[model samples]
Target: MHHLVQSSLMRKKSMASSLPKIIRHRELHGEARQLNRMTCRVRLDQLECPYLVEISGVKRLLDITRECIFIGLSNDSRYAVGLLYSFSDSHHSSSMGHDEDEAELNVIVFELSATLLRPVKILIFCYIFYTFFLYIY
Candidate 1:
């Protein structure tokens, strides 16, 4: 087995150029004027991607991909779960509303694809944000 430090270095080298670009925030433009847009364009090479990839050096990464904030793995490492939150799909589902309700609370849940590298959609949540919570509790 390689030492932690050595493993880390190898990973860094392989992923250094493949690192993904994340969009922290986004704003919708009105019909009257369109000025605000992608400002987090990284290296200008991480071109817009629609799906995730194990290696991105050759392929473009999605400009708006699901954000995985947390993950939980089984003790035996046989099973895994993750929490993905992203607004990347909003533009396709419908025009983002100016307010919460209008936004339609665009949400999606993904599971690792058969390759164990890319994420595959397992659920597409279309619900009222606050109201959905109320029903749960």
Candidate 2:
């Protein structure tokens, strides 16, 4: 039992030492992007969109006001979620509209699970949109 523990400790030390250290945020982000690109086959560039579609019983629009922001990893890093501010405009108008300024904060969660047996590379899990309204006084 003592020998087994010692061997396991040695293996852990070796493994820890073999891993490369990332000291900068850019480096870490780059590494993560690279890993995501290689494993998911979808580049991070594609995520920057001004709008997204919510598919339920009826299709809805999630209008993004700004660039999509990467939140972090989820499900033990098997997935990643992004945050974006969007608005729903049910009405179409030619001039400046009242709904144009309305926006909602939403989190877009996507699956990053990649496997040889699985046919799909990436799948959108869900979009959690917060209804809290922000009004300027």
Candidates in order: C-alpha RMSD to true structure: 17.9, 11.9
Q: Which residue segments of model 1 deviate by more than 4 Å? A: 1-66, 88-116, 130-137
- The weakest ten consecutive residues by lDDT in model 2 span 113-122
Give one digit per residue, the lDDT tens place, for model 1 in 4-100: 9899987744442321211111112211211233232243224332564332122435333344333543332223444443333455445444334
What is the per-residue lDDT of model 2 for residues 21-136, given as tens digits with 9 covering 90 to 100?
21122235643312322223334543433333653223544433244576765424445666655454556321434344455555566544332111112233333344688899
The models' CA-based lDDT, in order, is 0.34, 0.42
Clash pairs, candidate 2, are none
Task: Itemize residue pairs with steric clashes in candidate 1.
Answer: 49-62
Among all windows of ten consecutive residues in candidate 1, which has the lowest summed lDDT? 22-31
TM-score: which candidate is best? Answer: 2
What would you estimate as the lDDT of candidate 2?
0.42
TM-scores, one per candidate: 0.28, 0.34
Off by over 4 Å in 2: 1-43, 46-52, 55-67, 87-98, 115-137
